[model samples]
Target chain A: MIRAIRSELLKVRTTSLWWLILIGVVAFTAVAIAFNMLATYVTIHPGTVGPQQGGPDSLLTSVTGLYTSGQYAGTLLAMVFGILIFTNEFFHQTATATFLATPKRTLVIGAKLIVAVIVGVVIALITTVLAVGSGLIFLSTQHADLYLGNAEVLKSIGLNWLAFAIWAVFGLGIGALLRSQILSVILGLVAMLIGQTVVQVVLALLSSYFHVKWLMKIAYYLPSSASSIMTSPHGADGFEWWAGALILLAYGAVAAVIGTVITRQRDIS
Target chain B: MADGQIVVTGLTKQFRKVRAVDNLSFTVQPGRVTGFLGPNGAGKTTTLRMLLGLVTATSGTATIGGRRYVDLPDPLRIVGAGLEASSFHKGRTGRDHLRVLCAAAGLPANRADHALEMVGLTPAAKRKVKGYSLGMKQRLGIAAGMLGDPQVLIFDEPANGLDPEGIRWMRTLLSSFADQGRTVLVSSHLLSEVQLFADDVVIIAAGKLIRQGPVEELTNLDGAARQIRVVTPEPDKLFGALELPRTAVAKDENGGFLVTGVTGPQIGKAALAAGVELHELAPQRADLEKVFLELTSGKAGIR
Candidate 1:
């Protein structure tokens, strides 16, 4: 198992995927922070700037919410990293060599899972630092009060890290279940970005038509909703903190089980 | 009883509506090179994959050293396989590709370099696989397979893109591997090449075993069935006189009388008795190429 893990790490290190993903982290975080800084600057110097639509409260909200909104981009990078871990093997036909070297397919999958989590944590931490550093510099320049040590700020950062970790593992599970590199990445991004939103909107419209609140409650239990609950500030009409965590955990558990079973019986060809 | 023996028993694989391999069975003994021959779509790759535990067999078993591949504690140390020459990530360097396998097998890192050197790929080890030609990729695959220095080695079309010199090098490497008491099973469509070094031959067609035996025995099984060509000025009289029971007689494109199922001495005697002046009389030896064509052509059922 240790050897397999080492092999997986070596594979990731030798490829260019890591550098591409890190670039994504820097670009996404920088853009989000830049937008927040622009908003803060506009709020403080209203005389020099044209008439603004919103007040400082809204500006502050977007500024502080960089940890949540900006993290979405960072976690997506982690998710891509996870997807490539298995898809690259399938696309390159290296899976044959991989399975031949270690006939126990489960060990290979396990090693990939381990690497995914480690990469997830490291990427999440790096992006968080970027957001925090940029937020500090920008907000301080605008003479705005930056709550660097606030409980809510810290909670949001920690949960965002957890979110990235879960998303990475989730990507691995999806990759294993669907071995196509293009399809897995596309479907995964769709589910994260649009599928859940479409579901919530359709459910809300249906609930309004039927005059039933329970129909809307079903959205709260979805994997996306659980993730939003953890990554978003406060709560959004879903399970409490621990319950949301458990639901997200359940997704990971199910994905892991199904993915492992499918891969074990699958032919490398 | 050899340590690297491979025993496949009644191995079968059905891919949905098509039976890719049908009750195929063959054994590869240590200290010998076994050539697995088959036509296109003949299930050679499928069978090798099954043996390596990459694909699940529908029925029967393929074992190396009396144990299934999945049951082996460290499979790479016991069995090394190059099932496809292009089974590599084009983005990775050749050295890193072998290094990954070495790590999995728990071998020293230098083994990757050593194997590359053995395959004459040490100079190109630092280059990415994407830049390699087909022959270079084949050498890299062989280097990866030999990284662990396993007791058993299996290759599927290992000479697909190799030049004649590279093919000869591969042949020498495989022979040396077998000479060291290791087992080597290679599948190829090149009959003449397999004839060069194969001690045992296992032939398959339509996913079924057609024939298998020592190379010499299979080629020289029935001397009477060997072909004989007689070029003579009196083609009609020679053809008529050469007629015999169980003999297939036909006129060659060059107006020569071709006879099968009769010894060259018998043809000579009949020609002398008939007073047919023969310009040239020669026996066509049954070689691996002829046997392969005959067996696969479905003309004569050798198995």
Candidate 2:
């Protein structure tokens, strides 16, 4: 297992995509920080008026929304990483060499999962730190209460990081199930964007017409619907943070199980 | 298993309605290069893949070292195989690719360098595989196979894209591998190439093993009854002088005597004794190509 992990790490390290992901995450975080700082400056010293009605907290709310977008961007990148991890074998005909080397196919899959999780967690933590640090620095110029020590600010950063990790796992699941970069990316985009919107709209229409409030609750638990639980200022649908985490975990678990089953039984060629 | 022999029994594979390999049974012994000779689409690649456990067999078994390839602990250390058209990750350096496999197989990292040097790819070690020519890619594949110094090595048309010098290099490499008492099974469509490298030849056509035996046994037509052709002034006298049973003397295109059931040397001795000036005396042995064509043509219909 240790050897397998080492091999997996070597694969990840040698690819140019890994460096690209890291650069993208850091660059997006910096852009998010700059945008927030510019907003704070514009609101603090208006050209015509002395000050704005709402302070940097409104800016914080918008920036926090941007953080979710950034998290999704990171997740998209992870999806690409995960797909390449497996599908590259097929493309390069390395599956034969890999299976011949280890012979135990499941161990190879397990090693890849472990590597993906470790990378996902580390990248998420780093992105969170940079995002929060930059946001706080920008907000400090406007004399806003956006200090890192602030309870709300700390909670937001923590939840954002947690959400980022979960999103990464979610990407892994999608990548594994689809097993092709273009297909996985399309499925991921649909699930993250159109799927959630469609589900929410249908559930809203159903609840309003038939008084089926339970349907709305069910929709909230769906993979995309569950995002609100992490990104919402207050937890969505009165569900605790742990409940949302569990829902995401369930989604990832199901995806992984399906992926592993297909991969193990299918012929490598 | 103890001798590093590969035994395959009742091995079968079907791709949809097409039987790519059917009831293929053959044993490749150690200390000999077994040439897997077949025409194009003769299921050579599929059989090799099944032996390495790259493709699952629909029925029967293939074993190396007395265990299924997947069941073997440290398979790469036990068996090394190179498939044609195998592509390494284009983005990675050749050395890195071998290093990753070495790590997986629990072989020392230095084995990567050794394998590169062995295949004469040491100079191109740092280059990405994308830049490699077809012949260079083949060398890299062979390097990967030799990384673990395994007991059993399989190469599928290893000399496909090589030049004359490269082909000679490959022949030397395979001969050395077999000389080390390792089981070497190499597949090729060219009979002349295998004729030089292989000690034993296994011929297949339409997914069935037509013949497998020592190269000498497959090529020698001694069992077909010796035949001799002679050109002498006295054809009847030459035929009568060679008083062998079941001897047939027939007219030749050049007005020489065509003789059978008598060795060429015996005919020459008979001519010397009979005072018949011989114009032609030659031994006829069936070539490997003729034997291969006859066997595969016969098997093609039954399959």
As for candidate 1, its clashing pairs are none
- Which parts of model 1 have CA positions greater than 4 angstroms off? A40-63, A67-69, B243-247, B251-256, B274-276, B298-303
For all candidates in order, the CA lDDT equals 0.84, 0.78
lDDT of 2 by residue, A1-20 (tens): 99998988888887676888
TM-score of each: 0.92, 0.86
Interface RMSD of each: 0.7, 1.2
TM-score of chain A of 2: 0.83
lDDT of 1 by residue, B32-54 (tens): 99999988788889999999999
**Which one wins on TM-score?**
1
**Model 2, residue A58: what's the lDDT?**
65
Task: Evaluate residue A111 in candidate 1 and report its C-alpha lDDT on the 0 to 100 scale.
Answer: 96
True contacts kept of 2: 0.76
The per-prediction CA RMSD against the true structure, in angstroms, equals: 3.0, 4.4
Q: How close to the true structure is residue B52 of candidate 1, measured as C-alpha lDDT?
A: 90
